[model samples]
Target: MKITCVGGGPAGLYFALLAKQRDPRRDIVVVERNRPDDTFGFGVVFSDATLDNLADADRPSYGAIRASLAHWDELHTHFGGRVLVSRGHGFSGLSRQRLLAILQDRARELGVVLRFEEEVSDPGEALATSDLVVAADGVNSRIRERLADRFEPRIDVRPNRFVWLGTTFPFDAFTFYFEESRHGLFRVHAYRYQPDRSTFIVECREDTFRRAGLDRAGEDETVAYFEELFADKLRGHRLLKNRSVWRSFPTVHNERWSAGNVVLLGDAAHTAHFSIGSGTKLALEDAIALVDCLGAHAGVPEALAAYEAERKPKVLALQRAAQVSLLWFENTERYMALHPLEFTFSLLTRSLRVTHEGLKARDPAFVREIDAHVASKAEAQSGVRVVSADAAPPPPMFTPFRLRSLVLENRVVVSPMCQYSAEDGRIDDWHLVHLGSRALGGAGLVITEMTDVSAAGRITPGCAGLYRQDHAAAWRRVVDFVHARSRARIGVQLAHAGRKGATKRMWEGMDRPLERGAWPLLSASAIPYLPESQVPRAMDRADMDQVTSDFVQAARRADEAGFDLIELHCAHGYLLSSFISPLTNRRTDEHGGPIENRMRYPLEVFDAVRAVWPADKPMSVRISATDWAPGGLTTDDLVALCGMLREHGADIIHVSAGQTDPSSKPEHGRLFQTPLSELVRLEAKVPTIAVGNIQSYADVNSIIAAGRADLCALARAHLYDPYWTRHAAAEQGFAMEWPDPYRSVERYTLRMR
Candidate 1:
């Protein structure tokens, strides 16, 4: 079989070499628009794990690349007049020109033809001759453009301006230098790739670049300005340029990686942001996957399909992380107010792939320092005296947090999870054990499940409620038990199920209507939660008034029952949430249409509740940051909604997503919802409690220390272990008080250990 690869970049060259190595009998030729010696970028970086993968694929080229690699284990963050160094993050870098030379030599040695200075405007000639045609061109692929209809490509041009340059700094570590100028913040991603040369990349927001006159400046002037700005760290090193010009990164994505006999590879197929330093790595990895797939599959079409199926998901994951890192740099101004230590931590975890435990595994001492600082700040704010100067400060999870007049002993919150064990909307002993144990277990706060505002509003017959006096009296017993036995604050989440109401218990069948005893539902529009479920009545003025009164009365009862905080349940297709999400709310009245109109009823209900709830106690609103479906709620909508909620006296926003519609495609992963909370906190300038997929003490510490969220609520973790926070404290070796009756158990357990 004959294979022709277009372009002589890393993707084309590496694929040509690997395919030849896989089958020495196969004929292969690589076409290049530039000479083999011509290259643009200075250096490319790779992790040690990537090096291992390369060595397994081919040893000779791997040995050659490894011999010339500049390796480092330390990451130096220079911010706020201080340099913080973290070690054990292994990385290697090599000159891009040298890498291409090695690949070119290896391909030639493997009997693959390399055509230099020959541009292929059309692949028709090669397609007619070769059995397989690979479009391994770089970002600007002529072949990909020619077949635009076949491979639908979407290119998103990012906002920040960056230039790739080299310097003779002789740096030994992966270094990041941040400097605040009058124009804005300028950042440098510098790392040594050779004995005397290092890759220096300068990035800034578009406005900052324009303000500094870089948009109109020539290469020499651009280099001079950056040199002068970061002169202190450059140490008189000279900056060199090889066609380095300011350009915004274009993130490329292709709908189909292959069309007919031609297959797209590397940047022509997809491009992750450079902030994550994954372009070259992804290209090489793609080469390996494609070659392996081709060797395993007998047909070219099957090989191409399998290659994309295996590689697209991995590339997209990294691209998502890279996008997060890109946004962090774009909004550097927002994090400038953080302390230097926290700023360093935030930078390390910007991609969200690096968690507190990930850093702890790399550098335990650095994580300890972060934990100490967080503990000290929390204590200082609460006016608590340290027991001893040398005593280890508590972990971030054990630190005190305040909201209005309530001071939580820690940052861990037991998220509201429905038990569906109530009787006639009245709390029972089950409530006392469920919520009371969690409060005793060491959480700073525990929120009850969706306590409905009215009997007709309940999701099921067993759902808890706050509408009746007996309900308030029953909740008081549980609240009193929590208050008497622990310092944890208790709160109630008042919700009305709306179109999703009258469903069976979760164990019985979630979202399924009860065989009997089902009640009529109400919503912002006459839409059914499911096709088989009842279609709810479109709420009129009277329905809105009655619901508003129900919420207000529930708030009064929640306060009477001694809840320290009140959270309005405006999420998960509930009554208030139905009025906010466009998917569920399609009313033509004043309470629907645009998002502003949809938010009207929810805000009115919030106002009514706030008017009755005690002023000293804080109130929060739980919102679905996104509906995770097309034409549904988006982050932009969430930001606007959060701002409005803040204006209407919400102390915090509980950031959640999905469950607004059944067809929503939510991306579930570890700490999936935290990014939504972080965006809300930064964009809306509102405090947020991140919920969903959060587990472990390290998660709480990382979220709070990085200021991603003011608090973290865990549902599954708390359900798995009511003493989750207590276990975390013990794991961190912090001394926390135990219940008087359980003191003996703690002592016995410690002695056994």
Candidate 2:
């Protein structure tokens, strides 16, 4: 079999060497448009784990690379007139030219042909001639462009402008330098890759670049400008250039990594943002995975499929994390107002890959200092004196949070989870056990699932409701039990299913219309929730009035049932949410079209409910911060909506995302919705409850301590462990009150701890 690799970068060269080593008789050739000695960029960094993989794959090249490496274990951040050094983050860096040289030599030694100064404009010709064609070209790959439709590449050019250059600074640790200029905030990422040379990449927003005249400045002039801007940290070092020019980082992604006999590798297939420093590492890892897959499979198609199946998910995860880090740098100004300690911490954990516990493991003393600082501030704000300053206070999750007149014992909330066990809008034993158990589990607040406002508003026949007197009486029984048995405050989420109504039970087939007894639906527009679902009648003035009246009546019942809080469920493609999302609400009347018009009806409903509900009790609104689809609500739109809600007497905003359309693409992961919560909380200056995949106490602590959200809601985790909060308190060694009946058990657990 003959294999030809395009563009002789590390990914292509390494693959040539490994494939030859795996099969000595295999014919392999690496083609490059540039000379063997010529390369762009200065140095590439890798983690200790990556070094281990390299050593296992090919020891001689790994040894050569390791000998050339400049390693460090400290990350220094120079910010706010102070330098914060965090340790135990091991990284190794080597000059890109040297690394490529080593791979080129190894490939030649393994009987692989290297062709320099040869460009392949048509990858299809190479694919036809050879058994396999590997496109390992850089971010702007000609072969990828030639076969763009087959691969379906998606390239996102980031907002900030960055220039990659080198300096003779001799930096011992990976360093981040941030400076505030009249133009905007400028940041530098520098790390030593040789005894005397370091990679220095300066970055700033586009507005800042234009303000500083960097867009028009020559390469030397740009370097000079950055040198002056970062002079304090750079000292007297000279900045060197190698075709370094101001440009936005293009994050490349391919829907299909392979088409026919051709496959993409490294930057050609995907590019993670450089903020995480994983571009080279991922490229090499892809090379390794491709070689292994080829060796394992007999057919080229099988090998390509297996390679993509194994590597795509991992690359996507890293890309997602890189995106988070990129966004953090783009919006650094938002966190500039934070205290220096928190600012430094936020910088260190920007990617969300690292956690408070993980940081503590790496550098216990540093984490302890941060904990002490946070505890001091928390104490000052709460006026709750710690019994012992010598002992570290409980984790921030244990800290009490105040919402208007209500003071929660902790920041943990049991997010509303639908049970679909109610009968004709009346709560049954299943509802009682579900809500009552979480309350007993020691959550600060327990919110009921989307309880319909009227019979026609339910998503299914089993959905709980607050419309009928029987429904109110049934809910009162459960609420009374929780009030008597636990200190947890309960809230009711009053919702109208709108176009999503007349669905079968979730266990049977969620959102599917019932074979019989399916009622007609209504929404802001005459649209169906899905292609097969019922087409909802466009709500007229009478329909809006009745819905608003139903919500007011539900609020009255919720109050009478002794619910401590009321959350208007206007999210997740519900009735009010239908009006907010452009994809669902296509009406051009006074109730839709522009965002202001789209928000009109929801605001009216909120106003009516606020007028009827008790003034002292807080009312929260659950909103889908983004539809996660094109031509839908965005974070900016949600922020504006939140501002309007605040003006209309909303006490809190519950932040959730997506489910507005079937085609919506949600970036799912742990704490995925927290960023939306952070934006709304800061931009709108409204307290927020963050819900979605919040799994642990550490997450709760991080979200609260970082000011990302005032409270975190856990759903599935609570279903698996009803005593999640109690166990969290135990794990953190904090004393919490238990019910009288469980006092003995609590005592035993405390003693065991």
Please write out the lDDT profile of model 1 over residues 172-200, one tens digit for every residue. Answer: 99999888899888888999998999999
Instruction: Give the clashing pairs for model 1.
Output: none
The candidate maximizing TM-score is 2
Q: How far is candidate 1 from the true structure (C-alpha RMSD, Å)?
A: 3.3
Candidate 1 has an lDDT of 0.90
**CA lDDT, every model vs. true structure:** 0.90, 0.89
**Candidate 2 per-residue C-alpha lDDT over 433-532 given as tens digits, one digit per residue, 9 for 90 to 100:** 9989999999989999999999999999999999998888999999998889998888899999999999999999998888899888999999898999
- Each candidate's number of clashing pairs is 0, 0
Model 2: runs farther than 4 Å from truth?
121-125, 380-388, 732-735, 743-753
